[model samples]
Target: MSIRAARERGRRETFARLERKYRAGEYEEVEAEARALAAASRRHSRRRRPLPQWQARVLATGVAVAHGRGTEVLPELEALIDELEPVDPEAHVLRLIVRNNRVTVLNGQERYEDAETEALGILRDVTRLAHLTPLWRMELSALGALAVALCGQDRHEEAEAIARGNLPRAAEPALAGLHAVLVRSLNGQGRHEEALAEARRDPPHQDRRDSGLLDLVTAEALHGLGRRGEAEAAVRRALADCERHLHPAHPRIREARTLLGRVTGEGPGD
Candidate 1:
């Protein structure tokens, strides 16, 4: 079978097992395994060539690096980029994604300048893709901010602009996770009120666990708003949910707890 076909089959089998777990396995363990499978599936999709194939590769590599998939993702990215490097920079989608993926992956791994350049290149290409949707536009902006952040530029302002621009539309769509990232960008800029407003406007929910980042942003905004008690509660809930749904050592989980402790001076169990 083709690589794509194989991945698809693996995913189908994994999810079939997942369904059985959902039906009979222990709740917490099954949920945890399901989340892992979902992450792996996303990584698989990102690496496989399909629509916007390059971007998918980059995104997949980024997640892989962020989750410490390490050499498994980066080498593949480099090889793919090499194949597409001769293509027009604007249309060489695979190359562009590989470049950007390099940036996100390296940046996550603390290889700053390299990552920044790759990310910027991807952003430039994304901007030039005249045929973009509102969804893609927001994603491009957010990715632009990520590149800028890696480059150590004034990224928060840009991130906030992109996030805010897309925030209103988010409520109607299922972009709570994107909105949550914007909330962090807002909070980073001390736009606490706007961040709080955004959080209130889109409260976290049970099924929205992918948006665990939302909890961190909301908690921080609340703490800044002098709603420490509420912030603490939100942190506890977010942390608990994240622990339940994600790998224990996820950096986002560490970040959430760190911010929570800084704000409330209390642990999750406190």
Candidate 2:
């Protein structure tokens, strides 16, 4: 098998094991194994991607997720900036993109403040790339998404400035999707009313019935607006849809059940 394929398989197994432990109520074991896997991946990636530091940083995430520490991969993420700097001028900054989703997940799982603070620092420095690379447009779009993560952490003023200052050349409407996430970030910070207003501003791009992830986010936004009844209904609908339409092992389904438990005040394992 290819190296990528082998690495991917390891990650898939880790997620499956994590789900089983979550159901079994094994939280301590869950946290430990997650930490170990993350550590090992960092060591492996360092040796593998010595030049482009971003790729090395991104590799650790795959390792973290594979070991079921997907929710707490920040220490590894901190290495992104070092890789981004004059550390390697030849690095493909635009292609160092998947890390964007790791930042996005950090916002969702309650690490918003940390994710936001760090991402802004990167935006400030990536200006170095804006005038030099052929993929300025792609990198700009990525920076916009990262800005969204920062914004959703209740850094609206910062998020707006980050997006406006850097997004003039981006092709994708990444900021629009981020606005949806901001709805939750605001809700987390006791800005529920504002979050509700933003949630209503656009038809969400992530409302597909077959994807539990979209449903969970929609449910959280709804729940935040004192629409708990609708959130419950949405979670049930997502679970039903996935059980019927998607693979039983799909990641979205696992996340939906976890979020549903949090929303309904009863764990899905019940």
Candidate 3:
């Protein structure tokens, strides 16, 4: 199978196992299983042909990120970019993917300024290729990352505008993530009603982690709107879902727990 196909298949299989574990109430095993899957994916190498060497490395970088080794992957990704042949169009495309992933890693790390700068640079470069079909997905990825970084910087209005403007009409996973970012930006701006509306929109998929995040955003929006009872319930559900699927120490779990506390008129907890 091609690298992308292999990666997708691995992810689906891993998520299926995770769901089984979750349904069996084996929450403690979920994180370890996820990490193991990521490690195994990184170790499963295919011959480099239909996919370029850099493309394979990008896939490996994604595995590293899944294993929470993004910091370690970034320098290596940079080195790969530096080694790329200048005139190679395929290399250029892979470079854009690498750069976009770098911004994503930075955003996850909460390095807002750095992410913002990198995302902007990506946007500039992508604009030149905006009309090209192959680069369109990368453009969308960069836009989503830029919106997220803007939210991290507390620039809620701009983030919301960008996210809303760029949101795809199709029910693609990437668009779902962008919609979540839009919901977060709305919540940050105290537009609770709007945030809830956005959250209520159809999601791209039923992925547990994404669903949990959507619930968390919904809970915060409800809380901001003074619907304490509903907020608490939403947050509780978010906490349960997230804890079942994510690492115990995952930031999303902590955020959900903190929101639950606030909704209950208590300070942040757990």
Best by lDDT: 3
* Per-residue lDDT over 111-216 for candidate 1, one digit per residue giving the tens place of the 0 to 100 score: 6566556656666666675364223533453364363353244467766666556656544223554566677777777889988898778464423235366777
User: Which of the two, 2 or 3, has more lDDT?
Assistant: 3
lDDT of each candidate versus the true structure = 0.58, 0.54, 0.71
Query: Residue 179, candidate 2: how far off, in angstroms?
Result: 3.1
Give lDDT tens digits, candidate 3, residues 173-253: 467678888999999988899899989977556444354877888888998899989888899998888776655545576
Q: In candidate 3, how many Å is residue 185 off?
A: 1.6
Query: In candidate 3, which residue pairs clash?
Result: none
lDDT: the better of candidates 1 and 3: 3
* Model 3 TM-score, all chains together: 0.72
- In candidate 3, stretches whose alpha carbon ends up further than 4 angstroms from where it belongs are 1-52, 66-72, 130-133, 168-171, 206-211, 247-250, 265-270
Lowest-lDDT window of 10 residues in candidate 2? 204-213
Model 2 C-alpha lDDT per residue in residues 119-142, reported as the tens digit of each score: 555455456665765545445545
lDDT of 1: 0.58
- Candidate 2 lDDT score relative to the true structure: 0.54
